[model samples]
Target: MRIEIWADVVCGWAYIGKRRLEAALADPAFDGVPVEVVWRPFRIDPTSPARSTPLEEALADPAVDNALRVCAPGLSPGENRTRVSDIAAAEGIGPRWGAAWRASSHDAHRLLFLAHEHGGAELQNAVAERVMRAHFVDGADIGDRRTLAAVAAEAGFADGAALLETGAGEDEVRELLLIGKARGVATSPTIVVGDRALAGAQPAEVIREFIARGGHRRELPDEVERLRHAEALLDRRDPLGSLVLLRPLLDAYGDDRNVLMLAARAYFASAQLGRARATLERLVGDTPDDSYARHLLGRTLQRQGLAEEAAPHLSMAAAMSPEYD
Candidate 1:
């Protein structure tokens, strides 16, 4: 059996999910099953700086919300930490989250990719475990290449830092990230067993039940349902989640008006101005009379400081529809 886990090293829930998965696999029911687990990248904070501020301090700022905030809204960071720590403690993995620093996980994912290239799945898992431990338990600066190399050394790679300097896993890590996105993996600690996926830090019992289903190809929702779900995510202010669901649709329905519109709206909401502008331009090109598309394109261009270019589109949209005005 094979399981692909999409997660981030710094995500507390992912750390807890790892422990839960281990416990589930350790159960006597699956004693003879040979399960190969592959770790994949999913950046909960894709735009986080390399190593800027302490996690505790960042969480204190209302402006800086992390995956925890996205996952469980209405709870403060301290409360979220307490909730995660309590759960992790029960699972025998006590995380010292207070000591953790907020940093980008790109290098950490790169190291894991390198580990896989060096020693296959076993080595990759080892590197991932050690890296997560370094971040959540030891509060090591994971964004720093030097710190990562030291962690890699502890995970059985002697020249880990030197290997990182070679930039070996950069492309592979990015490809893995794209794979996760294509698979609609919006949440961390998502375990994809066969065709089925269970997201979040699911309980051991729940995970075991899911794994027991074998590799049955689960039925996928139709495109209409998917578009509706993506639109709902946008309404909830979850552009990333919306994009995750829209990725496959964008590929399958690349020219569909509804798909393009929703994707463009999500891109705009997420501040991915380039993507938004491109998608809107495609929509406007396909149907020149689309008032909303013109208006959104104008807004997107304006947001990017192309005011002069936006004026004509904004004027056209207003002339076409009073709502745009």
Candidate 2:
């Protein structure tokens, strides 16, 4: 069996969900099930600025406070580090949420994507586990490249600094975000099993029930895999390589959403702004509710010096995916 979990590093419930899933897999019933788990990237604050926000200020926001309370019941509307700490302690996963939990998780996700690409599932899981612990326990700013590099190094990456400096895995991270959004993953800690999904921190028993139901393993088709490789090429800062793969796929699968999105990305990365605009416009027209498409379309227009036309799309994209800032 395989499980794909879409979650953000800063999401408290995602940490809890990870623990619950671990417990479920540890159950005697699943002792020999031989499961594969993959973590997919989802940004909790994609629009967060590069600078860090004070944790207290973030906690003071009603929405943020509410989310914290949902993850750790009885958490007050103000700074409730103690309450969050207690919750983390109960799960045996941390030092606790504290002053260090403020920052965008975009960069952290990029590192994770790189880990998965370079070291496979075990390494990716290790990196993700450490990142979540850093954010929710030790209160480390996962957004900072240095912090992420340290975590990656500990997770067995020998050249974390170089990877960060090169901006490796960024395009893959963005592509994963779009894939998650298109798959209807609107919340952190959403575990998809075959066609069914379990959202939030579900109990171990619930997870076991899902296991018994037996979901089909999620696998990308060959064409989609080609598109994914193209995205990775783009992430490596190779626009020409990405376009080589994408252009052929576009010719063959012109209307396929994933193909179009990858082609648009390739064009944008290569500075073929007009082609990008045309592709994105068609994508947005086909899937109006796709937040990623709208966001990219807005960016494409903005790059073409059409900010006036891009503003509404950008605003709507942000509104639709508020977690992205």
Candidate 3:
């Protein structure tokens, strides 16, 4: 069976749905199955500047409303609830909605391309998960080349610099948008199995059946086992339950920035200006060009009574936020 998934990494459904598809493919039923997989291009928010914008700002933009609606609030990236997709992640065909909504698929998808170059399918999956976590969970910007490259490298990407170059390099991404339009793909998260199109966030069984039935069937569910675990944790509502669940997710995924960011924010919120500065400093070392990271770092400096030192960072952040300003 040949599985051709026409998806954008920015598409939360695609990020979530890809997990479900993987779970089904790992089934014993597919142990000996022959599968040919390909990732075609489709950009729902093709003109969204392809840059990493803060979630708060992106939500307010009128330009990509259609894209936002399709991705859904089910993919909402706020401080509180991410979504049912998150709680259902381990169940079978659900995603993790508890992350921030820094929705930009270009960087993440580009990592997959790099993964293909370095590690083939396995690496691709690893890179994909890293990107999802960065944008969704870590609340970091996947659209930022430096950030994406860091995550990719942590996921075992051999060429971090090379990957970043590709991420910042997206003439091909624009081409994919054209391909999507030509093919009549109206929305993102569209999975192409041969010529078959599977749209929206679907159940794992649907994915399994699709892959099992051979070319052009419903798609299979995500990993039932993982979703089951994630669901169990969701029901507990333990303050640290999700945190505990997040351990491995972070481990397999990239935990560096998210952990650092979470800690930095906590310190900042509590007026622990020194700690926040320290944390962000480390992140800057990892992703020197991340404007938002720099923005937060500058804020920390201002709070710490270091206005003079914060000037450059503030200047850069403002510049990045200003094309329309």
Candidate 4:
């Protein structure tokens, strides 16, 4: 079995997903199967400047708030550091999200590429894990060559400093990133087993089930692909484009949970509050335990001056995500 994971070192959910996959592989269900794991590069912020940003300022960005809410619903930007730290602790990694600096992971990806080239999968995995821990737990500026070199050295690279000085593996890293983008990898922690992809931080049981089923490729239909493109457009702040793509899917598969969720998000982003509310209300009514839907519905209602109605849903969403503030 071969698994390729597209993720960024700075992604908290990717770190959690890595741990979950590790646990799944450790299960006795696949005791004798030989599995090859490869880590591919995916930059969360490809255009982010190399300069380090203060954690507070980074977390305060609306984009960061939205991303955090996906993983830890109802969490305010100010509370995300604590929420991620707690998750890291539970996953057995040291907690230091509060102290971490925010920067690009481009240079770190280059180092990982070099690690894989020189020492194969074991060394590459070690370097990648240490780099994530360095960023999420040790507060290291992973974009810095010096910081990357130190991490690479600790992971058993003999000439880590020289490699960084010469900018080794930069081209390979860039190529890998291009490959990931071409493969519809818009999010971190996209684990690819054959043609099957498991997005987000899936639980161990889900991963175990996937492994048990032979990890075969399940190609997505054209409509699902369109929906995914719509989602990407929404993430890139092109709500109108997303809506244009989603309208057809909405007519064809209005009852699809993913389509409805994307439609709601598109409507919300485009300031179509009524449509957002209607779509989300239907979604929430069908899936009451969906914290994301509940939060979105609450926000939509609040925007329309229905605070009294929104309060219960918001409260429920927050209660469901106990780590949030």
Candidate 5:
């Protein structure tokens, strides 16, 4: 099993999430489960200054505090900090957040890519642990090359400073960042196994369930590709599979005509008459002139044995397009 974690190095919840996932993998139930964990980059604050700033000063910045607010909505910055600290403490991962600085994770990500290239997932995960600890526990400025080089050496990379100076992994890291964005990675510590993602710091049991659900590797990386894949599943007469792929797309694009139409068709195929009716109603209401939507709505009503309600839509659809009859 390949588990990919998209997270920022400085994210407190991400650190805690890592510990929880480790615990899950260490459980006897998965003793021989051959899992490879790969960490991907996500910058909570891409515009964060390269130079380190005082923890309080960084917290005062809107860009910094906004991420905190996202993690703990309705809580003030101080409250969010306390909440994160408490959660981390419960996970046995006490972060030295008092004097921690907020700096860009670009350099840290680059070093991570280098580690992956050097020794694949094992070396990369080892380096990631050290890097995250350096940021969250030691309060080191991860953006600093010297600090990162030290972390690299600690992770058994001897020529780490030279590699940093040469900027060996810059392009690879940037590409991975773009890949994460393309994959719809919006939150820190988004755990992705295949195309299915569990956002935020989920519990170990939840992570276990997510893993055991058995998802294949990510073949569809973007909205267009995922939509196409869903349609292909529908074509294969796998309505449940199509619905699974469409779930996230529906959440993100519920208002989209194509998405709604596809969902209605999938629901209808799967004998979910109510959902199909509701979706078709919404689509028909939004686009009264859409012959296909009207036709689908009529068919859905007919399926529910509401022939009286289906009459006008069927007539209107046939009137608009003869093929709809």
Candidate 6:
């Protein structure tokens, strides 16, 4: 079966776990019955607001960073603050990350949903990395709708604005928490395999051994504590608490052209005209029958100060749908 991962985009341990899982999956030893990894959202900072500052001082709290290190090892939390942007550009899987220091969890979770819709676990990994890089490394404000939308556009995701406006992930966050409770997850990086519940980042060999056993046993170590504080701290209504869950899955799984066009909407909202134009142009040309594509393309073209050029696409869109302006 596929491997389902419960994690937050901002968690360093989750990143480490992701790398570990990738290594395992790539290993020639497990080549035949390879596992497809699913990145399930279990938001750690549900209450965090957009452009929120670090909880600790400017230097990053050593205690929390140490905790992550215990789970993964050799982690330097502040290091991310320095390298987030360069990493985002190089990785190209995540959105733009610059030094934006806010504690907004909504953007992180929302983009995860977007990535989920694009393909599956593979797409999720790419999407999650992009948004996280923006939040954790770039210090970008994840709380702003424009910021979120811009990041989504950069990552080739759906209109982040529409999803935020519609409050897409509002219910999903609550549901995922419930699932975590039922499964007895207490920490940031707990991974469940069938009945097996893994606490902490854990050693790869230990996780491998557990997986090798067919994952029938669930472990709740004495140190096991569920993820509680992080959620309460990050979830705020201004950005909308219920909204985080909805944001990630809307137009996620990037395979659909319509979704790509929708992502263009977010990009446009975020003022990423170049990418927005590119996405809309590609979608309109590839799927001329899609009225949504024509409409979005027309809007994108008009925004670029090409009203005459946009007229045809707008007309086609109007013809395809009686209500379209």
Model 2, which residues run further than 4 Å from truth?
Answer: 59-76, 79-85, 217-220, 224-248, 251-325
lDDT by residue for model 2 (1-325), tens: 7788899888777888898889888988887777878899987666566877777777677777776667556656454656546666787775445445569888888887888788878888899898888887777888788889889889997666588789787777876776565456778889998878887778888987887788774587877766776777777777776777676687888888888887888888889999999998998898898888899889889988999999999998999999544
Clash totals, every prediction: 0, 3, 27, 0, 0, 47
> Across residues 1-325, which tens digit of lDDT does each residue of candidate 3 receive?
7776677766667666777777768878888778756665666565556656666677677655545554454454341234545444554432334444545566556556556656766677677677767766566767777777688778887685585674443544444444454444665566666556777657777888776766544444433333333334334332233334334544564445665565555556657688779878888878887777788889899888899999888888778876312
Question: Candidate 2 at residue 1, lDDT?
Answer: 77
Whose TM-score is higher: candidate 1's or candidate 6's?
A: 1
**Model 5 over residues 99-175: C-alpha lDDT tens digits?**
27878888888888888887789888888888888887788888788898899889887776688899798866865
What is candidate 4's lDDT per residue for 165-284, written digit by digit as tens?
897777668656655654678788898888678888788899888767766656789787667767877777778767877777889888999999999998998999999999999999
Query: What TM-score would you give candidate 2 relative to the actual structure?
Result: 0.66
Q: What is the alpha-carbon RMSD of candidate 3 to the true structure?
A: 20.4
Model 6: per-residue Cα lDDT over 201-286, one tens digit each: 66567777666666644445321212221123123211122223223433354455434544566566656678778878878778
* TM-scores for the candidates: 0.66, 0.66, 0.54, 0.63, 0.66, 0.51
Please estimate how well model 5 matches the true structure, expressed as its whole-model Cα lDDT: 0.83
Candidate 3 local lDDT, residue 318: 74
CA lDDT, every model vs. true structure: 0.84, 0.79, 0.62, 0.82, 0.83, 0.60
After TM-score superposition, what is the CA distance of residue 314 in candidate 3 from its true location, in Å?
A: 63
Error of 2 at 190 (Å): 0.6
Estimate the TM-score for candidate 5.
0.66
Clash count in backbone of candidate 4:
0
Worst 10-residue lDDT window for candidate 2 reads 75-84
Q: Which 10-residue window of candidate 5 scores lowest in summed lDDT?
A: 93-102
lDDT score for candidate 6 against the true structure: 0.60
Question: Which runs in model 1 stand beyond 4 Å of their true positions?
Answer: 65-68, 95-99, 216-325
Tell me the lDDT of model 2 at 271.
92
